[model samples]
Target chain A: MSDMHIDDFKHEALDHIHHHLKTYVSVFVALMALTVVTVLASYLKLSLTATIILALIIASIKGTLVACYFMHLISEKKTIYLVLILSVLFIAGLPLLTLLAKYDVPVN
Target chain B: MDIPYTVQPRPDTGLYNAKVGIWLFLASEVMLFGALFSTYILLRVGAIDWPEGVDVLNVPLGTLNTLVLITSSITMVMAWAGCVMKDFKRFRFFMGLTILLACVFLVVKSFEYGSKFSHHIYPKEGAFYAIYFTMTGLHAFHVICGIVVNAYLWGPGAKLWKKNPAQFTNRVEVAGLFWHFVDLVWIFLFPVLYLL
Candidate 1:
């Protein structure tokens, strides 16, 4: 009886992952669509600022999809998120450092 | 005594030791790439006549590599799923495909880089080539690292599966996370470098 229960549990777990296959396929399709859009946006002859914004926004979305699903961050624990938060904070600081060095020089 | 959380979740962290370790490693990777990205921005904004990246880069090739990496991500997850399902054959097939796709990406990338060098376009040519080579070359290094790790998992590391199935599967999952992170970096790099 216990063996039967273990078999069922394994089956259910595998089935859950099998269902995620569809999510993966759909995400792939969305990513491809976004890629096409990214290339097209480049040729749209928009303002430099607009183009940069659009490209980055699209890239951010793609990055999120890969991180959440492909990297399994969607179901990750609090500890992993904590680590990422720290990383994001430091990364955010990097640009600030550059900006400081570039334009924030104190008057002599 | 054996390792405390080799195959089991630590109580405080609610994750295996390796999972936490890889994530921490990935965190540092983010900062490394982030600094380079900031440099790219400063270089572009400060330069007088920035090169038209789209004109210089082969978009079709970059697109192909993006597709290839995305496909490998799916196969990688499927490989782990196969392990979960107790299907070693399926795992091997998908793992093999992931490694093959990684090799293809590197080959295509090298082709792109080689053509530039053959044209005598070195990183010293301009700020554009400097940032381009630095960013993509670093990314290519990550791809090489992924290939080495994945290759190990595919070869002798496969023995671990028979020794301890749970630990083996966890190792695959951790590796998948790294592989996916690599793909994530490319998703950003594709547009920022090539399209922008």
Candidate 2:
């Protein structure tokens, strides 16, 4: 039974690694496409809001690719994944919170 | 409980220990730079005048440095691959080239920084100069550290490349990952600080 469990685990791990490799390639290609679009967007005379929004979207995609592939978060254990998720949540929320606080004012 | 005579089976986690360790280290680094980037954004947004005239930065020089750094990344990866293939001669050659490329990058960066300093474009000039100097200064420091570390690994100091080639490959791979991260950060900074 113990030997069987070990074999099963090995198979599962290899499968996981293979699946992640495929996904990583796709994400990397997507990131390159987004980068090109972002550069093209800059040349056009888009409004400030539109430009900022597009840039942020592209940045998010790039960040996701790095976090998942280069950092190996996609293949990490559950505990590690939890830590990553918490960090992202804190990082993303802090900017929004700061922006809202800055714009808040007393109204008559 | 009586000890069992049967040999315990080792679990197959698939990931090697070094790979996992490198990823954990990278995660911490991400947080470190994340805070710096957040501060940059906050300051840029809160500024009233938006610190105009930063276009004084030499775009051609910056572009050249970008290419040099990117080429270094490629060479570093090639060095790692050479070690994996047990080609010590090629590994050393590529590592030497990587170090040379990194030095070229630093020389160009120093020229850029020197020109700014000669013009008295210190932090006291304005907020734009303040942010500009701080960011680039920090990046230059990282490049210096990377070069020093690469030299130690490829030089006679450690000599792990000769003793244990696999461990040497791991070291080179981790260093390559960090170097790539540095290049990635500059890719964003180049457009924002120079082109934009």
Candidate 3:
């Protein structure tokens, strides 16, 4: 058997840490750009449907930026990602599901 | 020679402890405010003629408060940087400025709320006012809580500042996270309550 040790694990962890720090600056710039886009989109007089859709799309981009960078979800363990995914599902699903009930009701 | 007491370093999680804890707390807060926002949207959609007279909300003042809160966020971050650099004087200075800014935010918010109260624009009457008061009231409560926490962390009686500097930074960072959340909520509230 070879005398391999846990030092390799430590070295790999350090490499990943270095990569994360390097990427963080780019992530911050992207988030800032997304914020600018959202603000600009707000100024357009799109119809209600188009406006809401565009706003939601921009919001999603911003949310992803915050989750991945500020929250460090990208570097986090898989279990944490699972928990976050579950949270998004619940937060997003409940509102849509409730709105669906409104569709089934007859309008006067 | 006098014997020096060696301070124990906090366990390193590779990230700052206070920053991590504050972010976790903010996650829950997002859910709390998220529920309020959903309620507002539902009520607004169901309203027959949405609340009129909302134009009474002072846009200029609200805009001022937004600038104040955003500036405070910058100060808070600077304070955190001071901690990383171990610059106690700058840390205290920025932290004090953040608290003052928070108080300014509260005062402006109070004026806006007071205007509503004087006009009998309450949440009890109809859907618009209901969502309006509920959302704004809850946010105001958060602002008050933030102010109190800021005072505790930066006030003269703060033990964390004297005993353990790292712990103090952690506390300030946590408070800053909450402060930023308060600002984030207002970003959404401004357009919904004042502009739209």
Candidate 4:
């Protein structure tokens, strides 16, 4: 409430921004590097499974960087985490269910 | 009535109201795109002869757009950070840059789409093009939406900063969240549609 305390809070806020800015730049460089890696890997002519897995792994890492750094999910609230967790559960379930239905045939 | 928790974290949730709202919205978005992704997987698995994306789609353009979007994501984050630092000019610069990058992405995408159309490759061409058009089109729509929101924040919505800096910062943060989610979608889409 005092003016001294207000100045202290301002310094703290500025420090946080400085730290976040560094992270933003670092994540950006990493993302660009990974983009190049993904593109190059595609031309390697790996088998279908290897190709899919490798591409996905790179994409997931890139996605995580965006989510954690750019989206600020790394410091987000527990409520937000819960919402995402539930959504991810269903997102994961959707494909598994689809695959199951596709392969599940009535035995003659 | 003034909205509570616009600038301050709520007691129970420990986040500003918009922060909670945006994440919930993003969660649903994840499901929406996830369903389409599942459909893609289903169709690809069932098809006897799936077309190679690299053979059909323009990888160079896709790669270019990928870099554009990634750059926008960083700028978007920097814009929010600018607000956090109480630097209005910095915020406007980065926010405008983000919008411009989004525009570049759309321009590139339009060229890509135009080439496909000229080649008579519509969504009806086959399952591959169908999913390709559907996913990238949806992602592009999201990009447009982000541009509109960011333009407002940079142009008019930013007035809120003078009135309530904390709330304005929160708005940018929320917008950045959505923008990054769009970028995240493209990170996956680029490889899945253009490369793999």
Candidate 5:
């Protein structure tokens, strides 16, 4: 009876691993498709502002996918999320402070 | 002494010790890369006439390198899954592929750098090349670190799988998280430095 139960548990673990593998492959495909879009968007010869916005958007999506799925952040615990969110807040602050300082320069 | 919470999750934190440690390290890395990105922005805005990345850098090579990194990321995650599934052969295969893809990225990147140098284009050339080499150089260094870690895990370090499979798997997951972070950085770097 115990042997049967152990076998069942092993099968269940394998199933879960297989599920995660499928998700990993799917994310890979999405990332490649986004890469193609990014290159094509560049070739569109859009204005600098438009190109920056579009490229950043695509990159953000790709980054999020890698973070959430590939890095397993989606299923991570509160402690990990806490650390990540804190760092993100700081990183977000960096560009804001940079831009503010850039524009606040003294007029010659 | 055997480490506490190496394989098992901590009661309060609900995560293994190394998991938390890697995330903390990655957070610091986020700040490191973030500052460099800010510098890039500052230089671009202050320049009177900044060259387009597509014009200055090899976009095709950059794009190819991006794909290579992405593929490596997938192999990395799959290797972690292999560990979870208790398939040592699968783990080794995917891990080996991840390292190979990383090498391909470095080779392509070296070619890009070599071409630039042949044309007398370098960090000393201007702000664009300066930030480009600084950011990508740092990133390539990280890639090399990833390769070293992964290769160790794939080769001799894998002996842990016999004595403690769970611990070995956790090690792979930790390494995979770092590898994925490297790939994530490239995802952003590709467009910012090459396309945009």
Candidate 6:
């Protein structure tokens, strides 16, 4: 940070400001691969919990690629990350709260 | 007054106000969908005779829609890149592809929903179908919203490019961010709703 001039930093940042079409194609292919994995995993005769976990893991990978590349989160600033982290924190809590529903009566 | 930070970054945040605004909006959207997904998990975990989703949903159709969304995501980014490269014609072409893909997605989704309704598989059929209708119906609403946003940017919004090119490009990028978020949600929803 100290060595490079402020102008240099600006130039370096510009390099990533425009992503190439090739990267988008690669990401698209990766997403398709993960989608195939998810569908194939669902076809496996594993226990329900195992299948769910596997599918979610694959989905998470696909989601990560979309968010990082297409959403441009990888090149985003700290402020945006702060907002996203907060959102993730709050959203993560919803699932925990959902577990509370287990104590309630079942509909079926 | 004309919008501030439409073409320049704010000193403090080091980002244009619109960029910050979109991220905040997306963050909130994450929670909105997250809450529904949590409810799905809670419901599925608690239900006794939870029907198998694969048996009920058409996996082939879901897979095809996944491809549609993935292709749209690529086209969407290409559109935004076209803006960055100062090629309005390329931007319009890629954007048109994006809109077309979105319409195809909606058409396929409509067919899926139609079959369910025709078979009398209403939300009242059972818990699985209820959640299916609610979650997919909500997602479909989002698709409509995306279509409207992209369509506007392609039509009247393109006029902005003439007077304020930088700001117009920024707007396209912001719209692409939202489109990608929509695709991100589908990436997860496809496997959960259709396969698992």
| Fnat of each candidate | 0.72, 0.05, 0.02, 0.81, 0.81, 0.72
lDDT digits (tens) for residues A3-64 of candidate 4: 54334333555778887788889999999999999999999999999999999999999999
Task: Please report the candidate that would top DockQ against the real structure.
Answer: 4
lDDT of 2 at B158: 43
Off by over 4 Å in 3: A1-84, A103-108, B1-21, B52-56, B156-158
DockQ of 1: 0.56
| Residue B188 CA displacement from its true place in model 3, Å | 1.5
Q: Which regions of candidate 4 fall more than 4 Å away from where they truly are? A: A1-12
Interface RMSD of 5: 3.6
lDDT of 2 by residue, B1-196 (tens): 9222112221443344555455566566666666666777877777886642224788678767766765676577666656655567877887899899989988998898889889887877877777778887788887888888788778873476555454566677677767767766665665566544
Give one digit per residue, the lDDT tens place, for model 1 in B65-104.
9989988988998888888887889999999999999999
Q: Is candidate 2 or candidate 5 better by DockQ?
A: 5
TM-score of 2: 0.72
Give the candidate number with the greatest TM-score. Answer: 4
Per-prediction TM-score of chain B?
0.98, 0.86, 0.84, 0.99, 0.99, 0.98
> Candidate 5 has which clashing residue pairs, if any?
none
CAPRI verdict on model 6?
acceptable
DockQ of 4: 0.62
List the pairs of residues colliding in candidate 6.
none
DockQ of the candidate models in sequence: 0.56, 0.14, 0.10, 0.62, 0.57, 0.42
Task: Please estimate how well model 3 matches the true structure, expressed as its whole-model Cα lDDT.
Answer: 0.64
Ranking by lDDT: 5, 4, 1, 6, 2, 3
Clash pairs, candidate 2, are: none
For DockQ, candidate 5 versus 6, the one ahead is 5
Instruction: Judge candidate 1 at residue B20 and give its lDDT.
Output: 94
